[model samples]
Target chain A: MTGERTVGERTIGEQVVGEQVAGGGSGTDDFYGRLRAYEGRAAVAGGEGRDAVNEPMIRHWCEAMGDTNPAYPASAPPTMLQVWTMGGLSGHTGGSIRSEAYDELLALLDGAGCTSVVATDCEQEYLRPLRPGDRVTFDAVIESVSPRKTTKLGSGHFVTTRMDIRAGGELVGKHRFRILKYAPARRSSAAKERTTEVKEARRPRPVINRDNAGFWAGVAEHRLLIQRCTDCGTLRFPWLPGCGACGCLEWETVEASGAGTVFSYVVMHHPPFPAFDPPYAVGLIELAEGVRMISNITGVPYDKVRIGMPVELEFLRVDADLELPVFRGAVA
Target chain B: MTVRVGDELPPLRIPITRTLIVSGAIASRDYQDVHHDAEAAKEKGSPDIFMNILTTNGLVGRYITDHFGPHVRLQKVAIRLGAPNYPGDEMVLTGQVTAVTDGTAEVSVTGRNGIGNHVMGKVTLRLSLDFPHGEADSPQRGAR
Candidate 1:
């Protein structure tokens, strides 16, 4: 709570509890340790639907859902599988089908301070439609427990449960439900004021060793350099010490023409990463000297980067000490 | 990911929320107004914002890998959307193995929401190390 300050929704406090958790690392293992025990076990068993599918109830449900479709016959909506068993507005607080294990599980999570819960999603498959006045029976089992996930509300675990619904003792539908049980995160009051002192995220350091040092040194000088096998005239874009074709350790550097054409390209769009902007183009550029290398493509819309598009090499200053060779689209 | 006929992956349940639908749509780079804007969605014939296909695709990938571990790579996910998954609905995903080769498996998958089948599809998974040998050496199919 030290140095905590708050003005609005924003806040700045002390250092983050564990930054690794934000990066999806296993920093909150204890929270999940108590969760994994219930996986694949029966959460509720021998559950019987309170009411069989009937006409008046169907009309009520259809009216509530604003559904006006008429098919002459009465078939309950597949989504209504759970509706038949729900305690409804009054809520079914306790019952035989409600497993002690389920109660204990909620207690365990509550004990860990994750008292709030919100349903995240569900999936259902229907094998048969419910006719008027068909009794529904069901059973449910704990399916899986995900590790701690950071959501807007806070950090918590997602628990999934699966239910099998049957009509007249015949399998009809399967329902899977997931919920995030979490405690609301306490925002740091000092967070807004401390943001100015925050540094830029450091780029992942390149693995530089004796074999690749000189190539980076050349990049530092804004030169596009390629390695050539002295013995066989073989050229490679990636600066490898030895030639694969001739088994020669002796190699020399050659200054490239800094011109190339796109051989193949990919427009990344999903799963935004920290270090790079998505929907950007990355191209495998085949150089004029005939070796291909991958680099960031610039000066063209990510969608418009075509095969055989011309490009010219340019140096991009990535940070304080790192420079990278990037290719810019040449004017048509 | 290696599979034969009749293999079943464990079920995965998901509870739909405004945040889950919105974040999943964003992660998949889907910027449709209906996916994130509730008011816009209501105007466009939906009672509320619903989950998009890309989020369903990503969740399918998660379900497949969760069953097969991290080594199995999903090569293709072809799904057709059915009923919309509105917020406050629960989705259950189930899968059955249809075919298998040395290092690959093809699975038939279905994700069902409260209303009905949200997405039905076939997934092709390639297990990188299922065997020592890689895929077929030659592109040509030699006729007997």
Candidate 2:
């Protein structure tokens, strides 16, 4: 098969290898043409998820997002469409059905000095909810690759892959993931100097609407308010217009006693934002009234924050126009 | 419990912290370095580790269920991301019903962060409005 291919005086294999080594410049058009050829080719074929749809991952996701919807534990979250297909830290291993065309396409991009990569976005369509014990399988194709274009990061191409996720041989969902493979843009001296004059970014303002305006109003007066259903007398935090227990619309505000316990918490460490410092503790505070709210845990070091730790409500004046309700953990 | 076209669902405010970004990524089984390792992310020309699309999708799903109740079935979620959800930012998710027929509602959702719109798309969900009476506990109830 190798001997059969020929191009002019040289074999086709030799010509292909020579072209790859001669990367950009005159071959740029040919390079993109080769990339486009990968479109519709199998990226992953008959791939199996590292783990089945399970409750532990779902529970962990709910805890991280502060989502307590009971429907979980029964059925997996529809947004977890990609979770079942992930390869995890070790990445796709033995059972991986990865195709050579996909690898070759990426190598082509790498040879062109477009090494840095970042996921741009993804789209998902859930045909049905995934449940526990369902064996997940998928097959993906190289959907498309855009022409070389310069972006804020650098000059690169956008590669999109589409995957069909299935469980027990039945189609369950579809996912499309797009990424940019680019060469990092060099920073100019002027840009570096400007960055040195670092101006702190202001904290994001809270979104206050008709349903929760009264709660913020109470915070301005240094009071933590919880909404109580007028019909069922059920207490709720982060005010809602209707009662979840009884579906009552009428609600009244009650001043909280300012007492609470840390139900769960996480310490922020990476991806520093301008407004707040990192390594800070954010807690899901369960109030004495049985309602819970998310707030910053203060008056103690981040690592010191513990589950079940007692805390008191306090208003933090982040800036001139912004104030937030934070919890001050009891310092031992 | 009748969902009409043009009816806007209540907004949901989610605090974007480093913890949420990292934890959400891990929970979704996405071990991409850019979603958890700041140094690796910076090397790739990102300011820092940012939120993964799976996390954004999860948040969007949660926002919808929180409004329509836990019984709703999510049919589809198609989103395009703009600004990255960095730590210490807030993403306020707002949705409006664009079409409603045969017990299914199509909602156009937008998640805005401090920098700009983090995610914008549409969500199709089937709502069975037959929620059990007196079962209204807050969705934020501690799972412990």
Candidate with maximal TM-score = 2
lDDT per residue (tens digit) for residues A227-320 in model 2: 9999999998778889999999999999999999999998989756656667788899999989999999989999999999999988999889
Q: Which docking category, incorrect, acceptable, medium or high, applies to candidate 2?
A: incorrect
Writing each residue's lDDT as its tens digit, candidate 1 over A1-332 gives 11211111111011113222323445446556657888878888888776667877666554433334453127664445556666543444454476777777888878877776645544555566677888888889988877666655466666878888898889987766666677656556434322322344455677889988888888888888899999998998687879988989999998889999999998889744446656788899999999999999888888888999999999988788778899999646
The list of candidate 1 runs beyond 4 A from truth reads A1-31, A92-96, A187-332, B1-144
Interface RMSD, per-candidate values to 1 decimal:
17.0, 11.0
lDDT tens readout by residue for model 1, B1-144: 334556788888888888888866553334667889997774333568988654675567567766776555555455555567899999899998766666667677877888777767666666657533223431221320
TM-score of every model versus the real structure: 0.37, 0.61
Model 2: per-residue Cα lDDT at residue B113: 85
Alpha-carbon lDDT, every model: 0.68, 0.81
Best by DockQ: 2
- The collision pairs in model 2 are A244-B136, A245-B134, A245-B135, A245-B136
**Model 1 chain A poorest ten-residue lDDT run:** A4-13
